[model samples]
Target: MPSPFRHTTPPEPASAAGPVRAVYTQLARDFGITRAPTFVVLSSVPEIMASAWALMRESLIAGDGGRTGKELAALGVSEANRCPFCVDAHKMLLHATGDHALAERVARGEQPADEDQARVLAWGRATRIPGAPELTPYPFPAAHAPAYIGTALAFHFINRVVSALLTERLLPGNVQRFRAVRSLGGRSLSRTVRRHPAPGAGLTLLDGAGLALLDHAGPGPDWARATTVGPAYAALRAAAGEGERLLDADDRILVRETLGAWDGAHPPLAWDGLPGRDRPGARLALLAALAPYRITEEDVAAWRTPDRTDAALVRLVAYGAFAAVDRIESALPVRTAKEAS
Candidate 1:
């Protein structure tokens, strides 16, 4: 049967020599690197890889929890892409995030050092395979499946973006390596060859554990420090309590303003900050409060330009804050005994 993936045959070395040599020549001409080889024979994965870096950096600015989430997702994608460069980069990022053991496992492609890492890696691998079902046998809770699917889709989107850039040889450093990997000549295989009994069952359990970690860690210090804006959170809570939907422009403006203030004052939050922070609970609270507003790539892009200020940063903060709100509401049971009482 024909493959569903966009498989590109590796050009013959002689055929590749022209383009490979041309890329080096262009790099030399463009960058004026006369002495060293203009194009290092790295794989054609850098543009997407660079984008991943930018995305992660932006996510970090958005909030600590957001950074952690994006790091895991990036690791999953790197592993799926089978790009050693990305794998190495994510390992460093994970290490920086304080997950050394799991980072090592992901780098080596061995069984994850722990269940959390395994779930992420498995999810990443699954995203790379065509026609894989959204639901897996992994131990993830049924209720959390949508979130897992969201994670998977996020990775898928990143993978597609990276693959497009790499396949097109847009990244000079990766051109040679991409050509080499393609030339090594493996079948364009997908991971869905056989169904493992109880495959993905581990994910349900893993996701639960991840959620537990998030809960325990709270929004984390980064958010806690920024969201010292107590009045804003109070207003947000009151609005939410009154069922004043976020669609109202006034509500959005309030959320946007509060978050903007938070972002401006606080340092960019990172994954590593979570375990060492004093008030994970407060941080989590702030994040939980902010998770609900709809965010898009455009919103993220707005924060990326070099000239952004504290107020702009606050927009990102607001995005994270609302996101936190969404997460809290989604994860916790709504009809509690207190409410019923």
Candidate 2:
């Protein structure tokens, strides 16, 4: 099965040097996968990769809520984002958590039998809707909120990346559909996906240089604050690129201005209303922001007659995802502000 990764190929773990090699080894060992595809693709920018892994580890992978609840939240986010790839992946993980019936219910688009589980899923979906005020009265206790929030935020970024960069099927062929195969795959990963204490701040990768980015998110679950940084870094790094940007100066200005006025909700902008240039690249950026899942080969055809390069397309997608994330994060009331004072 040939990989669908075209814009940027996952780097060989053995060939990776220094920090990149360490990140690959740690993620592989801890994640219980031969290769963590998302990490590998993000490794195109090493700093982004390391910080993303750390935030995910601190929040979702190593947190308090059981695997069932966490995976449920992940599935909800994936479903809302319309990313079939992540939806399938989380369903497999949910099955691995020994809730076969529950997993099937979610995959079937039905509510879980467990009320708490159902609430978690509902919250996840709610977060995907931008500018959704009154996100208050969380379904879980204060202590458990971080894990769920972290998991949702992590997958929010992930779903966008996977939709843009990778193929839908978890495996190359139809193997992902076989219950036995998904179950076995989940069991294999069970050992490696243990929880860890939330590592609060002071990560060397983020140092003083990038610390300010965390402020935009305005505090909450420890995991949310940290996870917000990953997308921020991605957006900034892509913006800083010296190459020919897909969104030129005027297009960039339009996106920023339009996004500034956005109501912070999904299905917000109409297709034609989205800011775009006459060129294919700018039009693609508008499509990415308004309806990423709708992007198809025809949309890609508009930009590149031959084939899409990894750098610009990936960066543009990241920027669009972050723009949405930032809008939501900014709209929500600050959880950590009162505590800080």
On residues 98-181, what C-alpha lDDT tens digit does candidate 1 reach at each position?
A: 445655555555766557556655655554443344214432433333333333333333332233212323224443233233
Against the reference, the lDDT scores of all candidates come to: 0.33, 0.62
lDDT of 2: 0.62
Model 2: worst 10 consecutive residues (lDDT sum): 235-244
For model 2, the superposed segments whose C-alpha errors exceed 4 Å read: 131-134, 194-246, 261-270, 275-277, 296-309, 333-341
Candidate number achieving the greatest TM-score relative to the actual structure: 2
TM-score, predicted candidate 2 vs. hidden true structure: 0.78
- lDDT per residue for candidate 2 within 1-341, as digits (tens), equals 68856445666666877556666666766566646777676666555565566556655666556767878888888888888888888888887777778877776779998898888788777776654542555666555565566667667777777776777777878587777777777777666654343443313334333433344423333334344434433323333232225567877776667667766345554555653334666555545554676566666666664445654566666666656655555554436422322
Q: What is the TM-score of each candidate against the true structure?
A: 0.30, 0.78
Error of 2 at 135 (Å): 3.2
Q: Which ten residues in a row have the lowest lDDT in candidate 1?
A: 186-195
